[model samples]
Target: MTSGPECPLLFLDVDGPLIPFGSSSGHPQDSASDTWTSADQGNPLLTRLDPELGPRLIALGCQLVWATTWMEEANEVVSPRIGLPRLPVVEWPASSTAEGPRGLHWKTRAIVEWADDRPFIWVDDEISAIDRLWVDASHPGPSLLHRVDPGKGITDADFSAFDDWLRLVIPR
Candidate 1:
């Protein structure tokens, strides 16, 4: 809830980071076809979300913001399921595809703009080397562009990386 400049921003993407699309062993994507019902509102993918993630993310002590195509819908559909309260959603640019360089992810520029020179972390599966280069050149503050495996989702390793980076950017 704290979005002050002193707090580092954590721009979270819902798909690959929260819902693993890889193997059928650990993720819900395996039984999606058989288990989906009207109660799911047709989004079987929602079942892949880990309810335990909210507390883990909050413990990182950063301002969490939705940075997915789900937009504000992330607050309604994804939040409660993961125990997160309503969070600030990143508003993507209207011509996202048209603005960035070739191979650059569309969300890259807007995410940098949103951070506004404050330290930030962008977690998404779609991030590319081009996006990292762009952020390094354009963003003035510290940043970590962590790409998650869509097949595996966010792992404990990812949290460890976050902790490592936060230790450097945030004072204890």
Candidate 2:
């Protein structure tokens, strides 16, 4: 919420970006309770996150907003699953979808108003061109939308791309 005005923002996510696409399950309280993520490889979601990426990236000085379908489940489910601290979550809008909307991931509209004016990175699996255009046109400097490929875990290749973005594009 506070990420809009002057500070840089990182709208983080869980199910798709952090835990790998389709790698997470429903809330523990939900009737469709399932444990996401394969026990084999853990999760390659945050190769260069706050604690792991070290302070250099943290010195980028950005606020991380958990912009995912995880919603409240971010606390009940994702926190323990990924070993991340209790990060703030952005609630998806109350819209409708035909096939795969309500059950697991909800389409997020709140991100528009919540993004504010800060530089932001939207890391999600469901991001579309329309979403990218919306944020690119409206938000502040260094705003970007990164699509993490499903099934394939976040590899070094992905971080390499991010590094380019930070260095060449943003260059902060």
Candidate 3:
């Protein structure tokens, strides 16, 4: 099978989706159930990353792209720790001009622009109704703007939703 725009893109955000915060149990913050990596780089939160997530994400069969402020650093630090190979990074344009309607997240427009008519799933904690509306109006392809809970990060439920969507849209 050849990969193309039909192969959905999964735009991943590090802060909220991967390194969840504010949760009391089963989250990376628990420390007891989490594993620490030697490549901390003085950022303790890096230790909270669940290495298994990489395989889980890869299994989804989407082209994973780093869509966070971490940028290239995500490839260098986050990828290895999470057992993910280097993936594409979404570089935000060097300006503050992509303001959609009032409640949209700053990254909304850029994410849509990056997708460029390709089906994509944008996973971020800050998504809002405006962003969804904006994407629905602007992006001309199947898209899932999933908003993960910053407190819990990505859960099995999230993966289930992704699986359901992928099977329906990309069909493996």
Candidate 4:
């Protein structure tokens, strides 16, 4: 098994996916005015991640990266709190629509620029088939992109889904 957070890199989006985008009562702010509507705005989130999950992803030879609108926000704030290994920083692109605050094109572009021979999993709520197609076509090595609903939170169901994919892709 891999001993470092350098292979099977897992590109994580700090806002919507890792720290489910919501509040204390899980009040989902799906309104047009809720751009910064993540609990990450409230308190530290990753401190709450199940200890088992981090180790498991690492055991699978996965690395965690902050791939959100936060950009280097993780490097400044999230990483030290979560104790996640500091990986490369990714910035959002300049072509994102500024109407409602979602800038997925930027994320996609980041993925494209950051592509390498290492296998990766892009876990974000806004990714689509176009995203999957974009990376699969443009990047090197086998790729998996999972669109996790922030409303559901990263429950056991989430990990189970990831586990299924990992089992199929990772060699014994």
lDDT of each: 0.86, 0.54, 0.84, 0.62
- Candidate 2 to truth, TM: 0.61
Q: What digit string (tens of lDDT, one per residue) describes model 3 on residues 1-172?
A: 2347678999999998999886545644333324434445577666568878999999888899999999988888888777799999998878756655877778988888898988999999998888899999999999999999988889999999999988888765
Model 4 global lDDT (CA atoms, 0 to 1): 0.62
Candidate ranking (lDDT, best to worst):
1, 3, 4, 2
| Cα RMSD for candidates in order | 3.3, 8.7, 3.1, 7.6
TM-score of each: 0.89, 0.61, 0.88, 0.69
lDDT of each residue in 1-172, candidate 1, tens digit only: 3668789999999988987787646643333345434444777677788778989999999999999998988888778777799999999988867566789888888899889989999999998899999999999999999999999899999999999999998867
For model 1 the TM-score comes to: 0.89
1 versus 3: better TM-score goes to: 1
lDDT of 4 by residue, 39-60 (tens): 3455545434333444554555
Best by lDDT: 1
- Once fitted onto the true fold, the runs of candidate 4 whose alpha carbons sit more than 4 angstroms away are 3-6, 23-56, 97-104
Clashes of 3: 0
* Clash pairs (backbone) in predicted model 1: 22-151
lDDT for each residue of candidate 2 in 66-145, tens digit (9 for 90 to 100): 77665766655555444455667886656645233334334434665576554666667777776666566655566667
